[model samples]
Target: MPKITYIEHNGTEHVVEVPVGLTVMEGARDNNIPGIEADCGGACACSTCHVYIDPAWVEKLPAKEDMEEDMLDFAYQPDPARSRLTCQIKVTEDMEGLVVQMPEKQI
Candidate 1:
């Protein structure tokens, strides 16, 4: 299992051991973490699962595709350098201990 840490707006952190092949949003959703809603079910159609990749680990993640980039345009608190849809990031052994910073809002 890979571990993921989600840091919330108020600086609270929730960590979960996520199974490989699951998306980060799924990890958060399954663990009852409060920040991700996954409104489009990982389809890249919504930005409800938006999150910020920790700066230190940003380069390790897969680059955003066109669809993800488009949807990110609608994210509530978008930051081109750090924002990403959690659904687009799959859990993997190499990604164990991934840390994500959640925005203050996700509408």
Candidate 2:
């Protein structure tokens, strides 16, 4: 399992241990962390799971695919350098201590 820290817009943090292979979106939902709506249930079709990866951990994640990049266009406040759909970030052992900050809104 890998531990992920989700920080809300207000600076509240929720640390959760997520099983490898699960998406970060799933981890947040399973942990009952707020601000990750995951309205599409892990599907890459929506931006409700938008989050900004901590700069320190950004390079560790795989590059976003075309679908993910397109969906990000719909995110509330997308940041090309940091915004990502949580559903596209799969958990891995090396991802322990990963941190992501939720956007102020998700649409």
**Which candidate leads the pack in lDDT?**
2
Q: What is the C-alpha RMSD of each candidate to the true structure, in Å?
A: 0.7, 0.5
Task: Output the lDDT of residue 64, model 1.
Answer: 90
lDDT of 2 by residue, 1-70 (tens): 9899999999999998999999999999999999999998998989999999999988889999999999
lDDT by residue for model 1 (4-106), tens: 8999989999988999999999999999999788888888888999999999888999999899999999999798999999999888899988999888888
Evaluate all candidate structures by whole-model CA lDDT and list the values in order: 0.91, 0.95
- Among the numbered candidates, top TM-score falls to 2
Alpha-carbon runs more than 4 Å astray in model 1: none
